[model samples]
Target chain A: MNRTTTEKVVKSLKQRHRKEKLFKAAGFASVCFGFLLVLTLISDIVIKATPAFHQHWLKLEIDYQQEWLGVDSLDYEKLESADYRKVLRRSILAMMPEVSGRQDKRSLYKLVSNNAEFTVRDALLKSPEFIGKKKNVWVMLDDDVDSYLKENTEFSQTGIRISEKQAGWIEQWYNNGLIDKQWNTEFLTSGDSREPELAGVRGALTGTMWTMLVTLILSFPLGVAAALYLEEFAPSNRFTDFIEVNINNLAAVPSIVFGLLGLAVIINLFGMPRSTPLVGGVVLTLMTLPTIIIASRASIKAVPPSIREAALGLGASKMQVAFGHVLPLAMPGIITGTIIGMAQALGETAPLLMIGMVAFIVDVPMGVTDASTVMPVQIYLWADSPERAFLAKTSAAILVLLTFLMMMNTLAATLRRKFEKRF
Target chain B: MKKLPIILSLIATSSNLMAAGRDTISVVGSSTVYPFSTVVAERFGKTTDFKTPKIESTGTGGGMKLFCAGAGIDTPDMSNASRRIKKSELEMCEKNGVKEVTEVLVGYDGIVIANSKATKQMEITRKEIFLALAKQVPATDGSEKLVDNPYKTWNEINPDLPKTKIEVLGPPPTSGTRDAFAELVLEGGCEQFAWIKAIKKQDKNKYKAICHSVREDHVYIEAGENDNLIVQKLTTNPKALGVFGFSFLDQNSDTLQGSIVDGEKPTFEGIADGSYPVSRPLYFYVKNAHVGKVPGIKEFLEEFTSEASMGEEGYLTDKGLIPLGEAKLKKIRDQVLSFTPLKL
Candidate 1:
C-alpha cells in the first residue's frame, strides 16, 4: 500500500529470482551428472559384456586321414570304432611343427577338454571318409582354456586351483600357435548346456520369445475383451466395482503366487504339462492379464465420449460402437501396454523358476509344452554354474534382455506416434 | 544416521577390544558345515569367552565367492563347500588376496534319493536311474538322444523293470543337492553311456536337444530348490520320488526310505562301510589368514574334525548323518585336523 513497502517487495522479489536461477542451474548440472553416471555404468556393462560375446578360438586343422577310417574295407562298425583321434592329433601336431618335443601325446590331451578325443571321434563317425585324408578343422577348447588364455582365470593364485602344469601347457600352446581363441558367433547361435565349454543362449532366447509370444497371444485378446466389458458393457454396480477391485489386487499380487495358481489350476486341474513353456506362458498371462486390462480400460476411458455418441447417432450397433470404433481407437494404448506387460513378463525369473521353466534347456523348443529355459533363467543358471568364467556370460545375457526391452519400447513408441496422428 | 551415538560407542568398544588383541571373527560358508561349525563355535566361544562364529547357507559357489571376495576387511573368515572348490574358483579366491585357505574334507555326503516312507519298493537301480534321468539316450548313429518323457508313461527302459509313470521331485540348481546329483549321479554315469558322449559332442546344445524330441505324453517334472516341497509332493503322489541330501533323509527316514541306486540301498551301514555308492564328501575351507585374528578358530576347527565330530557315533552323525567307519574316519579326521593344503 505504501511506496517504501512496494520498493522492499520488488527488491525481495529480485533476490528470490536470483536464488531461484542459481538453484535451477544447479539442478540442471545435477541431472546431467546423474545421466553421465548412468552412461558410465552402461558403458561399463557394454565393455564387460562384449568379451563374452566374442569367444577366443582354438582353431586347429586336423588331418582327417582316410586310411585311418578303414573306409576302403566298407566296415562301418570297424571304421567308427577305431581311434580316429590319434590320427587327428598327429595331424594337429604335424600342422604346428613348432610345438613338438615339449610333451607326450597323453599330456597334450589334457591341455584341451578331456573329451577332445571324443570330439574327434564324433567327427570321424559323422564322416568317416575324411580319415587318412588331410582336412582342416577348427575346435574350441573348454571355457576354462578360454579363460586361462584370456587371463580371466589367472594361474598365479597360490592354492588348490588350476594346475601349474595345465596353465603352462595353455601358455605353451598359445605361444606355439597350437591354439588361438577366436570370437565364436556360434555361442550366441547355440543352446545352453551342462558343460560350461559348450553352453549357449539359444535355448533361453527362444524360450523367452515363445513364452512372450504365448503371453501376448493369450493375454491381449482376453485382456482387451475383459476391459471392453468392464468399461463399456458391464452394468455399473457393486459387483462390477468388486470385480474391478479384485482385478487391481490381482495385478498387485506377487508373480510367484500366480505360479502356484497355475500349478493348481492349469497344471493339476487342467492337466497342462509341467515345466512347459505353455504353462510358463499361461502363468505369465495370469500375472500380466490385469496389467493389460487396466491399461486397455484406461485407454478406452481416454477416448472422447463424443466419438461413441457420434457413432450411436449414426445408428451404429452397440457392438459396432465398442469394437469398430472405440476398440480401434484404443488400439495403440492397448498394444503399448500389452507389450510393456509382456516385457515385464520377459524379465520375470521367479514365476518361471516356480513353474519349472528353468530346466536345463538343451535344444531349442519346437512347441508349447517343450521344456525350455528363458533368458533370465539362463543368466541365473549360468551365474550359478561352478565355472567362474560364466560371470561374463551372465552380463551378456543381461545385455540381450535389455535389448529385448529396448525393442519392445521402440515398437510401443512407433505405435504411439502412428496413433497420435489419427487423433 | 539414527545410531550415531550407538555406533560411536560401538566403535569405541571395538577399538578397546582391538587393543586387547581380540576382534569379532566373521565365518560364512556352507549350510551343511554351518551346523557342525556353529556347534563347535558356540561351545568353544562359551568355554574361551570368544564370540560365536557366524555362518551363512549360501550354496558352495556363492559361499566361496563371498569367502574369497577380496574386500580384505569385509572378507569372510572361512568358506564351506559341499563339493570341492573348483580349480577355477580356487584361483579366484587366491587372486582376491585370500592368501592362505585351509581346505578340510570334513565327512561324506550320502546323497539319499528320498521319498515318503509310506511308499513301497524304495529301491531304484543305476540302469533304471540312468533311463529315468539321463537327458540323452540312443537315437540313430549310436549317438546320445533326448528322452523328453523319461518316466512319464513307463517305468522300464528295460523289460525287467516294472512299468510306472516317472515323476521325480528334486532340488533346483541353487542347492548343494543338485550339485551332488549332477556330479555323483549325472556326470559319473551319463558320460559312461557310449551313446550319450557322442550326442553331447555332435549336438553341443545344453539340455534342450537332450530334453525335447521325446514322447509328448511321457513324464518328467522339474521340482525346484525347496526340499520340503519335494517331500510334501512325494507324500501326496505315489508316483513321485524325491531326490535330496542324506541329512534330510536321515532326519525324516522314519517316514522315508532311501531309494537304492543300482541296487545299493542307502543306509548308515551301507555308506560308512562304502557299500552305498551314491555318497560324496563334504568339505570346509578356512581362510588361513584369519587363524590368529579370530579368537578360538584353530581350536574350534581342531575340535570340529576330531573323533568327536565324525566318529561311528560322532556329533554330526548324531544330528542326521551316517558317520564314517573307524579307518576312514581316522583318515578324514587326520586330513581335516592337519589343515593339509590342497593342490589342484
Candidate 2:
C-alpha cells in the first residue's frame, strides 16, 4: 500500500521475468545442440557412404581368341579353367597399343579389377554363343580406379594411390565416354569377399532375417505365455515376486554376457554348431526374452479389469476370458513392444561374435544351420579391413543399418498411434 | 500357458536333432597369420575331402594361451603366431599336459611406416624416430639423464627434416606389430645412446621399459586393430603417418607411400633378404595330440608347407607374405614333415 513497497515489488517482478527468459533460452539452446549433433552424425555417414552405392565400370572389347584362352572347345570345364587372364591382358593391350613393357602393362591392367577374368569367364560360361566372338562388355573397374573416379582424392597427387599415368588414362576414358557409373546392386545381392569391391551384405542380411525369425518364433509364444500366467493366473506370492524381480534384472545384463553364455552353454555344452544363425538366434532369443516378457506383461496389465469380468460374467471360463478378451485388447501394445525388441536384437554384434559368427563367410546362407554373419558383424569386419575402399563400405553399412532401425521404430510408433486405446 | 508346453517340446526336438562331432580342425591365433591360414584352409577344403578349418583371429598372446590350455579334442588343433612362443608359454603348456607341439615357420612380414601419398616422402633414421616417438629421451644436450620427450615437430629431432608436426597413428601395445616396431626400430635407436645400451647390461627389463615405452602425448595415437581407419585418417590429414603391415602398403601404394627407415625401403625383396630392418618371421604351432585326433590337421599343415604355398612365387606371396629362400624353405618343410617338436 506504500510507495517504497510498490517499487520493490515491481523490481522483483522484472528480475523474475529476466530469469525466466534466460532459462527458456538455455533450454532452447540445449535442444538445438542435441539436434545439431544428430544431424552432423547422419550427414557425415551419408556423405561418406553415397559413393559406395555407385560403382565405376569400364567398357572394353574382348576378342576371346581360342589360343589366347587355351581353350579349343566350349566345354564348361575347359572354359572354367581357361587362361582368361591372358585374354583379358591381350584385350587391354589391344585397346592401348602405345603402352609397352611389363611395368606399364601391369599399370594398364590395374585399370580393371583382378576379378575381371572371372567375370568374363562367368559371362562366357552362361552363354557359350559368345565364345570365339568379339564382344563389348562393361566390366567393373578396380577399387582404386573407382575411388579416383569418385574424386575421393585430388587428381594430381603424385604419390597417392592413383598414379599420374593411371589418372591420365582415366581422364582420357572419361573424355571418350568409356567410363560409367551405375548403382552397385551387387552390394545388396552378393555375399562378403576379401576384396572390398566384391563384398556384399546379402549373406549378413539373410542371416539377420533367419536369426530374427527364430528369435520371434521362440520368444513370442514363450514370453506371452509367461506374461499371461504371471499377470492373470499366478498368485502374487513370494515366488512370483522373485520371478518378476529376476526378469527385470536379467533385462539389464550387458549383451556381451549373454554372448559368453551362448558360447559356454549353447555351443560348448549343448554341442550346437558355432557361427551358425541357429546359435545366433538362440543367443538373441535369450537376450530378448526378458524384454519381450516385460513388455507383454505391461500391455496385459494395461487392459481394464472390467473386460475380464464382463467375459467371465458371460459364462466363459478363465482361459477364454483372458485369451479372448484381454489378449485382443493388449495385441497392439504387445506387437509394438515385440518390434522394438526385435530391432534391439537386430543391431546386436558382440553376442554373435562370441558365438563365432565373425568367420569370413562368402556364401549366402541357405539355411539357419549354415555358417553366417549378421549386418553389424559384417560392418565390424569391413570396418577392420585394411583396404581404403572398405572405409566407404563401412559408412554405407551404417547408413543401411540406421535406415532399418528407423523403419522398425516408425512401424512401432504407427501401430501404437493407430490402435492404442487411451482407456 | 498352453503355448509353453508346445515351445518346450519344440526346443527339445531341436536339441535332439543336433549332435556333437569333432571332425573339423580348429585354428586360432595372431590376426596377422589369419589370412594365410584361411587361404590354406580354403584350398585344402576344395582339393581334399576334409572340412575347412575354423580359424579365429585372436591375438598372438591370446592364441598361445588357448593353445597351451590343453591337448584335447575340445582344444584348438593349431595356433598361428606372429611371434615365437616364449619360455613362460611353453612351461604353461607343459604344466597343462600339452607335451608335444610342432612349430611351423611361415614366411616373414614387414612392419611399415607409411604416410598419405600427398606428402613428401620422409627418409628417417632410427635415432630420429626414437626421439620423435619415445616416452623419454636422453636430454638433448648429450647428458646421460633421461627426460620426457620435448620435441613436437619432426624437424626438432633433425633440422634437416621437414617442419611438419610429429603425428603418428599406430597399433596399441597388444598388437604384435607394435612389439616388433618397439624391438626393431625403438631398441635399434635406443642403443645409439651408449648409456642406455650399458643400462641393458645392468638391467634388461628397465632398459626395455625405457626403450619400448611410447609417449602419451596426442602426437602418438593408439589406433585399435582397425588399420583401415588409420589409412582413412591419414588421407584426411596428409601430414600424419601410420604404422601397418607391408601388405597394406602394397595394396594402397597408389594412395600411400612407405617412409624410408634406416636408409632402406619396406620392399618385399628387402624384407625377404634381411635388408629391411623391421621385419619378423611369422609362425604357427600345431598340437601333436590333435594332429591324429582332429581330421585334416596334418593334411592342412602339409598343404601349407608345400612348395606351392611357401615358395617365393607362391599364392601366399601374392597376399603380401615375404617368402623365405628355397634352401631355408626346404629345411623348414622337411622339419615340419618330420613332426619335430619345438625344443623350448
Candidate 3:
C-alpha cells in the first residue's frame, strides 16, 4: 500500500511542477512574440523609409542660351515669358541627350527634369537679361523622378517616386547620360513644406542650429552663474532651498505647458513673432535652464573641496580659487551638462509649434530673429502631410535628426570621457 | 473573469451588430464640418433611432485617404472637405469601389486674413501678401532669396494699402485652413500673374513650388490650427496678421479685425457677391450607406438642407460662419436631400 501510494503521489507532484514550467515557457514565448512584432514593424518602417533620404539626379547637358548667359539688370523686367522658357527649355534639353528627331522629344524633355517650372522661372527671374543668352546649366530634376531613381519609393511615376514610365525613360536617359543618382542634401537640409519633392530641412536645421546657439549662449552662462551662487555662495537656507524646489518643479513642468508659458510671456509680453527662432530659443532656454542649472550645480559640487582649499592656501581669494581651480575641474561637467541641455532643446517641438515655428520657411534662418523651422517641426510637418511620399520623407528626416542628436550625445560622452579624469 | 468573458462576448456581439441594416455611417474629414454634423446628428438621433454616426476631423486629405480606402470596415461613409477634392483623390475613391459619392457644398466660409486690432488698418494685395508670406517665389532675377519686395510691400503689391509688415500667422500644413489658403490665396494669387500662371500650367510642380514658397525666413509663419493662439498673438503683436477662416474673424471681431485684401473686406455679403475674393465653400459629405442603420445621419443630412440649419442666422452661421448665398445654399441642400445610392 505504501509503495503504490508513494509512487502515485510522486507522479502527481511531478505533473504539477511540469505544468508550472509550461506556463513559464508560454509566458516567455508570448514576450518573444511581442518583441518580434515590434522588431518586424520597425525594420519595415526603416526599410521602406530609408529610400527617402536618397534622391536621383537628372543630368541635363543643355547649352545655356547665349542670350540669357550672364543676366543684366537692364533686361530684367523686359524678359519675356518665351525668352525665359526658351532658356529653360534649352537647358532642360541640354540636360537630356539630344535625339536625332522628334521621336525623342517627349521622353527627352521628360529626362531633362527638375520639371518644376518655378526653379526654371526662378532661374530666369535671377537672370532676366539672360533670356536671350544661353549656356549649359545643370538643374535638379523633378522630385518624382529624382525620388524614384533614388529608390525612396517602389519606383512610382510621381510625387518624389519617379513614375514607372519615367523610370523606363530614365533608364535609357541614364544610359545616354541624362538623369543620374546624386546625393540628396535637400532631404537632409531643407525645411518641411507642402511640396514633398522640394521639401528640405535647411530652414529648420539652421533655425534649430541658431536656436541652440542662442540657448547655449543664454542658458550656459546663466545656469553656471546660478549654480555657483547656489552651490558655492548661497548659504543652505530657506530662500535657497525654495529656489531649488522651484527649479526642480520647472524641470518637471510639461513641455507644452512651457509652450503656453512662451506664448503668454515671450511672444505675448515681449511681442515676439510666433516663428522667430529667437522666441523658440528663448522658450527652450527657459525650459532647459533648470536642466542646465541642475547639471551645473551638480558639476560644481563634484569638484573636490580640497582643490578650493589648496588654491586658498596659496593666498588666493575665494573668488579666484572658485573661478580658477574649481571652475576648470568643473569644465567637463559643465560642458557635458550644457550639451545635454542643448540636446534636449534640439528635439523640442511643442514650444516651437505654439510660437509658430510649424510654418513653412524656405531659406535657412540667418539669425535668431528670422522666421524659422526646426528639425523636429520639420519632422512633425512631414509626418502630418497627406502625401504618402511625406511619410518616407518624414522617416528620412527622422534619421537625420536622430543622427544630429546622436552626434551631440557622442560629443558629450567623448568630452566626459576625455576630460573627466584630466581635471 | 466571468464578467470579463461576458464583456468580451458583448463587444464581439456589438462588432457583429456593426453590420446593421445597411445603416451604419462614418463621415471622416474636415473639422470645419464637424459642428454642423454634430447638431444634425442630434436632431436626427431624436428622430430615426438608427445607428449613431461617427465623424472624424482628419483634415480634407486625411479624410479622403479613409474615404478612398473603399468599401467595408475600412471604408468611410462620406468625406467632408473644405476644398474641392483632387482628381487623384477622386480617382482613388473610384478605384476603391466607391464609384458614386454625393459631393455637397453646404455653406460658405470666406477665408479671412485677420489680424490683432493693431493690424486692422493694414490692407494688402494678393501679390504683396503672397510675397511676404509665401515659402518662396519665382525671383525676377532667378536667385531664390527671401522676397525683398514682394509686390514691393502693401502699396507696391497693390496701390491702396497701409505700410505694415507682412508677418502672417497661419495654420500648419495639417489643417483645412492650409488647404483653403493654398487654393484660395497662394494658388489664386499665383494665377493673377500671367507668367506664373503659365508656369503653373506648364509644369504643376513649378506652380506648386512657387505656391509652396511664399518666402522662407522673412515671410509666413506656420502656425498650427489653434486659431485662439493666432488670435492671442495677433492681439499682442499688432504687426502680425492671422490667416484663418471667417469663423475665426467672426468670433474674434471684438478684439481683431478682418484683413482687407485688394481693398475688399471679407464679409458675408462681400463673399456672396464675389467682392471678397478669398471666399471659399464649406462642405459636409454624408455616409449614404449609413442612412438607414444610422438613425441620425440621414435625418441629420436632411436637416442640414432645411432652412433651420442654414438660414442667415442659423446655428451654423452663428458659429462664426459666413453663410453662402441663398440660392447656392438651397441648391446644395436640395442636392443632399435628393441624393440616392445607385443600385450595384
Candidate with the larger lDDT of 1 and 3:
1
Pairs that clash in candidate 2? A160-B254, A160-B255, A161-B254, A161-B255
Return the lDDT, model 1, position A384: 48
Q: List residue ranges in candidate 3 displaced over 4 A.
A: A1-49, A59-139, A147-177, A188-193, A413-423, B1-344
Q: For candidate 2, give the lDDT of residue A143.
A: 81
* lDDT string, candidate 2, B294-328, tens digits: 77877888899988788987768867899988999
- The superposed Cα distance between candidate 1 and the true structure at residue A20, in angstroms, equals 4.1
What residue runs in model 1 are displaced by over 4 Å at the alpha carbon?
A: A1-12, A15-30, A33-37, A59-107, A114-128, A152-168, B1-344
**lDDT for residue B33 in candidate 2, whole number 0-100:** 87
- Estimate, for each residue in A294-339, the C-alpha lDDT of model 3 and write its tens digit: 9888989988888888888889997898788777788788888788
Per-residue alpha-carbon lDDT of candidate 2 for residues A309-334, written as tens digits (9 for 90 to 100): 88888899999988888887897878
Candidate 1, lDDT over the whole model: 0.67
Better of 1 and 2 by TM-score: 2
Leading candidate by DockQ? 2
Residue B252 in model 3: lDDT: 52
lDDT of each: 0.67, 0.84, 0.66
Report the number of the highest-lDDT candidate. 2
How do the residues B1-344 of candidate 3 rate in per-residue lDDT, one tens digit apiece? 34645544653464354334334345667766655554454434333445444444456776787677666543556777887777787777778777766777777777888866754466667766666566655565654433444543555444556665557788887888787788778777767667777776589987787775556564578777656567667888887777876765664565778877888988768886778888777765554544454345546676677775676656466445666667777877777777753222
What is the CA-based DockQ of model 2? 0.31
Residue B81 alpha-carbon offset, candidate 1, angstroms: 15
